[model samples]
Target chain A: MSTDLPEWLLARQEPFQHGDGIAGGKSIRRGFVEKSVDSMSLVFRESFFAERLASRPGLLQGIDPRVKVLTTILLIIVAGLARHPTTLLALNLWILWVAKVSRVPLPMYLKRVWLAAPLFTGIIVFPSIFNVVYPGDPLLILINFSRHFRLGPWTVPETLAVTYQGVWGALVLILRVGASVSLAVLLALTTRWQVLLKALNMVFVPQVFIVMLEMSCRYIYLFLQTTSEMFVARRSRTVSRTSTQEQRCFVSGSIGALWNKAYILSGEIHAAMVSRGYTGTPKTLVSFQISRLDWLWSLFVLAVSLFFLGGDRIVAW
Target chain B: MHIPDGYLSPQTCAVMGAVMLPVWAAAAKKVNNVQKTKYAPLMAIGAAFTFVIMMFNIPVPDGTTAHAVGGGLLAIVLGPWAACISITIALAVQALLFGDGGILAFGANTFNMALLLPFSAYYTYRLIAGNSEAASSRRWLGGLAGGYIGVNLAALAAAVEFGLQPVLFHAADGAALYCPYPLSMAVPAMALAHLSIAGPVEGVITALAIRYLQERNAGILSVEASSSPLEGHSYKKLMRGLGMLILLSPLGLLAKGTAWGEWAAGEIEAKMGFIPGGMSSLAERWQAPLPDYGLPGFEHNLLQSSTVYIVSAIIGLGIIFAITYIFSLVQKKTTPDKT
Candidate 1:
């Protein structure tokens, strides 16, 4: 039975020291386990930074969470509705200006917004610039075809060049995405998660749904941390790299285990809360109060959104 | 698919939101009845489960890692209604916390992932695994097929939404304002990526997880798909909605063009520069009882046309109910009675 066991189960490694008298050695190669752990840590770090950023007394922090949420949603919708690049550019600038006053680091903030989803959107829309795609005035001819010929369904043009109309359209789309993402990022960076969930009622989200969102946000960390620890334990016991089959088995087992834990914990969580005099509705010590300043700031943001909407409608060709 | 904001036009986003509203309402009611007051904690945990599941890196054939969205598995275990709420909450967290998806496109994202993926997958699995034992291979294979079908359908839906943009909206010069790809490109591109890679990954992961649960906790697997949530529901609510829509049918006369695909041959020619030869030959094959929402004699009269619109709405609703009634009667007659 002992001989049939894999190498990982045979014995501990030599000089593989970890803290608190536990044997551990950093793996030489980065596998999926390490990658997942690093990713989880990155998530925790991002969340921690967001909490720190939210604690700071920024311009958005001064406003009530409901007002802040409402204004941010309005601005995001405006960004989506905006058809002109100029309007989107202006919205992006305004968002950055608020982020600057909110004590959020501009460089990190910009990178976070631009580097993730919008960057992907930019790549996806890159091909629309070609004349064959948009079929308009040639802006930059990249390839001069031998002659007009059919390549399957599409007719090949004399030259494959970027078009003015395509470039303009793509620019507008990219700017719109940038503006919308910036507003959303700024809101997430400035507001506490629990308060933000509560404030979703301003958008007519049901009370029960908001409560669900609050609890889920609170537990995402718990589950991620728990899963990360499992990886840490695996990393500690390993001397050599595991095979892909073993890795996949570990992953599937981890998922199944987590699901079981979640199912059991859900019952326990409700029972514990009930014992602690809990009700169906979530309660917070600090109640929401809208002040005069909140109203004024919210109104100002609303006015700006309207202006952008008008500008987009007027300026779009 | 998590559609980012600004990708879909405002109108399209609004339409998707409208489409999801009833599904959300139904899920809420169904889950509430099942879990009662205990739904919050269960759904929250389920949501967190999916959120963490998406973080797991599955090894691919290319020696790279990919993550499954986990919608299919959630539907399999938690049932469709609960899965809908769970995935929705997870999506909301992603949108608000990590800036992963568009804030405004939240509805569209939920419509695709939370509703379509879960419902389609759940039904597919249930259809294939009907009356099978908990440990049967047919059930696990069904889970696999469900996952594959679920993700691919979602991809197709996302592709169609993206493809519709150029056809529905554009700059005055014909440059696409939103997603630039036409249907031919968007559909095939999205389909290939999902069907070849994401579909199999999602299917394998779902099947593996289901099999693991089958071995460890057969009780949970047995409880899933045990009964329909809306089995005892009344038709009163459905009737009321149709009544309201019938009353409001005349308002649709305010729009100029017919709904897409319902256009006449002349209107098709006006929009597309020419009617297809097939459509031209088939144009006079049959005539609508109420042409353009009006009676034959009431076409030129505005008041009569509006009245006829209401009548047409009633006729449409009547036909639908008649068909439903016939189906139910047939189902009743076919089933064996213990008495």
Candidate 2:
């Protein structure tokens, strides 16, 4: 049966030599920069597609950016205030509806929000479900120890089970996280970056901050492209896996070189701006126009938020 | 150390936000006095550099890859104040654009990664480097220690913020509604992770980066020079900021055993055999405008409360700036030749 297995199923490496014990057991993966560049590019592509979605003639895409920003904040606040799981679920469904109308890719959107929240926040909340961690009514027993026990200064519970309250609390916590993340993701996907930044500006974000944020956003892609090229050039020149010290030295050197490049780039950028009569304040060509539809949408969102809050207040759980 | 939303209570967020506003105002004033126009593009690039640096994946010896937060390097390259603003902008972008952290939790995140991380790192580096020549090896050692301690301190702050959520806010059943972990669990886990992995990685990177810069360009630190008009006024400002934070820290203690909304008249009686007078009075009182950190007479809504908190923070920030300005003026009169 082992011989019948595919050759690719087995690990490929040199056999252990004389005096070598578990040297071959170690797994050393290469292409760190290549992997990072690939992932970063993936994120860039996703955000790029999202920007394209923002230009489409979708529901949220039509609303004023200021309204959308405020409405998103309002909805997120409601999500934070929510106590019941059902309320959070309803908010999740509402975000789905928004994403659907906004024409964002539903699978990508769901995967981005759902896969991340449960995977990251879920792990944090996982321990809370055990009776040993959080004392409550037993829901399902996982282990049954002696009648009583003691470990050091801490008393040990005789039985270990998933508590009903713990499970409910975890569910509520997860749902809140999921709902908030979904709303944030929805807002990000359905709005242009510049427009969203402008909205932040109108909402009393300092001009200096807005200027820095806009400039940073514009230059980040350039820097990222430069960084990836540097890594690829280095990788192409490599013969085999270099020592860890060499890698560390290379990373530090690359960082320093990048810093130098950024320094020069800043000077050049400043010169270009000065030549163009640029002042400290940032001015954009795209202006915000809140239409009648925007007001209606704002009211609709307000009503929805109030309804959720009222439902949370009335519900026992 | 980026705290996601719902991990901290709103009150905690408000207090931190209030604290940061003054610090930001002070930083801006100081930066403006140093290199007014030159610092603008530099700060912008610094922010962009920070944003890009966080994306770099470094392979550690443990057969796993982790990225650097770049706070220590930012402080070394730019001054700590400039680093604070740059990292704050980067963090805000991360929170708003990418949803990496919570919008509501931005204040706490900034307090941890931006202020505490860079300030602690920069000061530690300065203390250790201690008038050593620019090319001395002590600078590198200082960088190493600064970077390691910087990341650990940031992690500890974040862990405390997370641990406090459950103790400060929970359901009536004693079930944690926010972060479920208590301090004992949070602190040790955070400390161990940082001490073992990220701290050392940051230390190595910081030291190596400094050495590389020392070899290549000697003019980098000039862009982050220390001289400023308000040089002699930092102590009072720091004290005022800490005083504000201390005043608000007790709010965390106000409802030590109280849950969010599950308070029952008989439940307190059953637990303590008598309801504490303070607790009973608090429950009876009407909602304050700022509630906890907000101004009074604001509407009993989150938006209103948050708005008031922001206003109060702005007010506090202006007061700090005014005091600093007056102190500088007085110093200039008393010792006109000091500069």
Candidate 3:
């Protein structure tokens, strides 16, 4: 082994890499490993963001999670019942206001809700806004066929135009989805995961369900780390990208291997539980405390729900 | 695949939620009665395994990566009821922590993904693999068929749910207030995506996984059988033949057409005489928060509109990372060192 090195070379350290990960045959696809790493990082990033959002000192954060959970469901129901566009808009604004009070980054909150909702919903609802799907008065004429075209049981009209009512209907659907998602996102962002799970007890959520939620949340990161480690180990040993067939083989093998590990991991976890005082029921230390503020918030939510429902009925009549 | 909130009427959400409550309770009771205290940790691990399985983006021959819900695979491995419980928990976590699915729509999502998928997968696998030996290649074939059919069945169930919305619930003007598409459109649209893309990916993965387990260590199959090496070559050949078939399956999706309901307004008008009254009447009712996914002042012109969408996406991503980074920094600053 050569021990001698230049002073500059000795002082500078090489970046740490996964051990012996560069020795594969010529069939390797480096992109595969990178893609896995990228997705793994994405999982971690999302969790980190959620944890940060949950811990912020804000309006919803201070309330008891049980109250928040119930209130959110109630609000969602109200939002769903909303028929008038005005009422839906108001509810959306109210959710944004709640998000603001809860100290969630407003821009990020809007961005999150809108990005997920409108982009996809927009695509889904796009065709609904024309004269062909939902018939109504034409808002804008896009084309005029020389003669009506018929295909099987369907008929294509001579004139094609965007319908007035079709666009209206599409708008309502988009707004409703966007608002609903906003409220749901607000609830998740403002409450800690464990606390939220525990709060499900108030709704009589089964203890087993709660236990599963807690355990899954706890071990997901652990398993995720293990998976990335496995990938890294594989990548470190490969000098070139594996062939597609080999890639598929590796993926299938990894899935089976992971399942076996999960089986063993379950036994180990069970044994650890037993060692800790094996009981049928697992308990956590966090206790719920409902303050006047929680009650006030609950009352506020109830009142809003009533008003929205009432307004909807009035608008209907 | 997740139906966001507001796609269903409140009545629909309530009805679905009521239906799911009992299923969850029964599943919990059964699991508790069977596994008792040990059930919690094992099922949790299983659910966690499922969550990670979904994260693996398996590359298919079409130059696209697909993820299997693993509902069928789990059903086969842990039994259907256990799989149901595990998947429901994973879905709840997704809805609560990540907002991948709607909270109010949780029941519908659960019904489709958890109950429909796993149960269908279980029965289909059983029907095909009946009385087959533990190491029989037939078992793997059963998995392949079950996975392909299971996913398509679940997709069908979802499509039905979505399609029924417009017919079952509508405003006075004959406009659909919930999902705008009729069954005529929803079924084919959903079927095309699942059958062409997701089905084969799931089938191949499930079959390959089971085959690998059988070859590597059949002990995980939880069956007590004498070890034998005599049948190895035949099994290998069977798998290779199946592999070739799986590779060609994506070609079915190459049909020169878009999903029925997925066409643009212009495209639909060109295809049909007029938009369905129920869908068009309701669509014009409200403005999107981001009309056409662009900022208020910058809603027109292709260049600016796309730039706005991209900018908004980047902003959201940047802010999330930035806030988390700041939180970490703050925690470090506040904590006292043990020096």
Q: Who wins the lDDT comparison?
A: 1
B285-338 in candidate 1: lDDT tens per residue? 767675555577777776776677556545544443343344334433443332
Clashes of each: 0, 1, 41
In order of DockQ, best first, we have 3, 1, 2
**CA shift of A28, model 1, Å:** 7.6
Q: Each prediction's interface RMSD?
A: 18.8, 16.1, 7.8
Per-prediction DockQ comes to 0.23, 0.18, 0.27
Candidate 1 segments exceeding 4 Å error: A1-29, A277-286, B226-230, B234-339
Model 1 chain B lowest lDDT segment of ten: B330-339
User: How far is B90's C-alpha from truth in model 2 (Å)?
Assistant: 0.9
What's the residue-level lDDT of B169 in candidate 1?
A: 78
Local accuracy of candidate 3 as per-residue lDDT tens digits, B116-226: 888788778878888677678887897898889888998897898788787776677766788888889899999999999899888888888989988877766643112
Give the candidate order by descending lDDT. 1, 2, 3
Candidate 2 CAPRI assessment class: incorrect
Error of 1 at B94 (Å): 0.5
Residue pair clashes in candidate 2:
B290-B294
